[model samples]
Target: MLREVTAIRYVTPLREGGSLPGVVEADDLGTYVVKFRGAGQGPKALVAEVISGELARRLGLPVPDMAVVQLDPVVARAEPDEEVQELIKASAGANLGMDFLPGALGYDPVAHPVEAGLASRVLAFDAFVENVDRSWRNPNLLIWHNALWLIDHGATLYFHHNWPRAEAVVHRPYKWDDHVLKPYATALATEGPALAARLTPSLIREAVDLVPDEWLDDGGKDAYISHLTARAAEPEAWLP
Candidate 1:
C-alpha cells in the first residue's frame, strides 16, 4: 500500500493540462502535485497514474515518489479561485499526489539529450502502456538532477475507458514517429524486447495492486491485470 498523507494546506494551482493538478502541502511536511479526483478525467485517470507510475518505478525508471493524499474539503476555503475551490470540495476524499521535484525542468530534446538505451526503454514502456501523451510537442518528461524522470501517466492504458473494445486494441501497434524520444531510441530493437520480458504477469499484478481501492470501485483490477499481461505477452505487436 502507498503511504497515506493528509493534505494540510492548499498551495497554488499548477494550471497545466486540463486536469488542473495543484501543488499542495501535506501533513508529512512534503509538497506534492496532487491530481484531484474531481478533475475532468475523473478517478480513472488517478488509477492509471498510480499503476503506470508504479510500474515504471518497478521497471527501473525514474519517477517521483507517490502517495495517497487524504484531502479535506475545508482546505478549499482559502483558495481564491472559485473553480479551484469547487474542485477541492468535490475531491474531498482520496487523491493522487506526486512528490514535487523542486528544481526540475521540463525536458527539451535538444537541450537535454537522452542516452539511446534509456530512451529505448522509455519508448518501449510507453508503447506497452499505450501512452499517447508523450509526443514531441508535449513530452511529459522532466530533467531533474541531470536525469530524466517520467511523469503524468494518466493518459496511459486508455483501453479501460472502453472495456468492450479493450481486447481489440490491447495489442494495437504503437506509432512512434511523433514520440519525443524516438530519435534517441536507437536501441529499441534490443531494449524493447528485453523490457517486455521483464513485464511479467506478477509484476503487472503488483503494480495494479498499488492503486487505491476507491479508484478501483469499478472492480477493474482483474481487467487491468489481464489486459497488461496480454499486451506484455505479445511485445512484437506493440513495440515500435
Candidate 2:
C-alpha cells in the first residue's frame, strides 16, 4: 500500500495537460501534484500513474514518490475557478498524489544531454509499458538537480482501456522516431535486453501491488499482472 495523506490545501492548478492536476499541500506537510479521480480520464488514469511510475522506480529509473491522497473537496472552496472546484467535489475521496519536484525544469534534449545507458533504459521501459506521451513535442520529463525524472505516465498501459484487444496490443511494437530521448538512446540494442531481463514477474507484481483497491473496482489487478508479465517475457517484439 502507498503512504496515505489528506489534502490540507489546494495551492494551484497545473494547467499543463487536459487532466489539470493541481499542486496541493497535504497533512503530511509535503507538497504533491494531485491527479483527481474525477478528471476527464477518470480513475484508470490514476491507475496507470501508480503502476507505471512505480514500475519505473523499481527499474532504477527516477520517478517522483507517489501517495494516495484523501481529498475532502471542501479544501478547494477558495479556488476561483469553478471547474477546479467541481473536480475537487467529484473527487472527494482517494486520488493520486505525486511528490512535487520544486525547482524542476522541463527537459530539453539539447540543453540537457542524457547518457546513452540511462536514455536506453528509459526508452526501453517506455516501450515495454506502451507509453506514448514522451514525444519531443510534449516530453513529459523533468530535470531536477541535473537528473532526468519521468512523469505523467497516465498515458501508459493503454491496452487496458480496451480489454478485449489487450492481448493483441500487448506485444505491439513501439514507434520511437519521435521519442524525446531517442536521439541519445544509442545503446538500446544491449541496454534494452538488460533492462527487460530485470522485469521478472515478481518485480512486475510488486509494482502492480502498489495500486489502491478502490482503483481496481473492475478487478483488473490480475489482468494488469498478466499483461505486463506477458509483455516483459517478449521484449524483442516491442523494443524499438
Candidate 3:
C-alpha cells in the first residue's frame, strides 16, 4: 500500500504551512499537502510527523491518512516553467508530503477553544506522551464537516532530549481549554484509554518506515530510526 505513491504533482503552495506544504495530487487521485523542511528545521521534522501522527491515530485521535511520497522530476517540475523547477529541486531534502484536507478550516484554540475536561484530557494525554505538534497559532487541527481532524504532527516527542527534566510538569495544555472543549470532556476521556492501549511497538515501527528516504540523511538516518524504535519499544516511559 505504501509503495503505490510513486509521484507527486505540485498543485498550489500553502503559505500557512510555515515550511510551505505544496498541494499535491497523488497518482491514485488522492490529494495531499506536501510539507518540506525549511532552512532552520532539519528533515527530522518530517520524521516527527511519521512517528507522532501514527501514534495519535493508534490513540484514537482523528488523524488523516499519511504516507511518504516520492517526488518525480516530471511532477517536481510540473510548475509553470524552469524557474519554478529550480525552487522545487532546491527543497529536495525534507520535501515531505501530507494528505490535503479538503474544505478544512484551522481551529482556533482561543476563538475556537478546546476543553480541559475530556478534549483537554486527550490533548493532555498527547502532551504527556510528548506529541508536541499541536500548536496555538496553527493548531493543525482541521475542522471538516463539523468534525475535528489532526494533521502535521512534525513536532512530537520533543522531550526526548529532556527526558530527565522533571516529574509530571503541569500547565494548562492550551489557553482556550476551559471554554471550547470542556463540554466534550466525557467524550475525550471515554476514548482516551482505548487509544493509549492500541499504541503497540509494531504500530510505531510501521509509522517510522512511512517516512520518505530522502528525508533522512547518512548521519541522521540511523539516529532517526533508532529514536522511533526506542520510543515504540516503551510507550509507557517518557520520550527519549
For residues 1-240, what per-residue lDDT tens digits would candidate 3 score against the true structure?
244364457777776766656777877888877755542455666667766776667666777877556665567654765544655675653355566778988876555554434374456446434555554544567888777787766666553333343222222133333323434455544454445455565665666566666665554444544554554344335311
TM-score of each: 0.98, 0.98, 0.68
- Over 1-240, each residue of candidate 2 has an lDDT whose tens digit, in order, gives 999999999999999768999999999899999999999998999999999999999999999999999999888999999999889989999999999999999999999999999999999999999889999999999999888999999999999898889888888999888999999999999999999999999999998999988887564699999999999999999999
Highest lDDT: give the candidate number: 2
Instruction: Give candidate 2's error at residue 56 in angstroms.
Output: 0.4
235 in model 1: Cα distance from truth in Å? 0.4
Model 3: lowest-lDDT 10 consecutive positions: 166-175
Tens digit per residue, CA lDDT, model 1, 1-240:
998999999989987667999999999999999999999899999999999999999999999999999999897688999999889988988999999998889989999888999999999999999889899789999999989999999999898889889889987998878999998999998999999999999999999998888887564699899999999999999998
Instruction: Please give the ranking of all candidate structures by lDDT, highest first, separated by commas.
Output: 2, 1, 3
The per-model lDDT (C-alpha) reads: 0.92, 0.93, 0.58
- The residue ranges of model 1 lying beyond 4 angstroms of the native Cα positions read none
The alpha-carbon deviation from the true structure for residue 62 of candidate 3, after best TM-score superposition, in angstroms, is 1.4
Clashing pairs in 3: 32-100, 34-97, 59-195, 114-181, 115-181, 115-182, 118-185
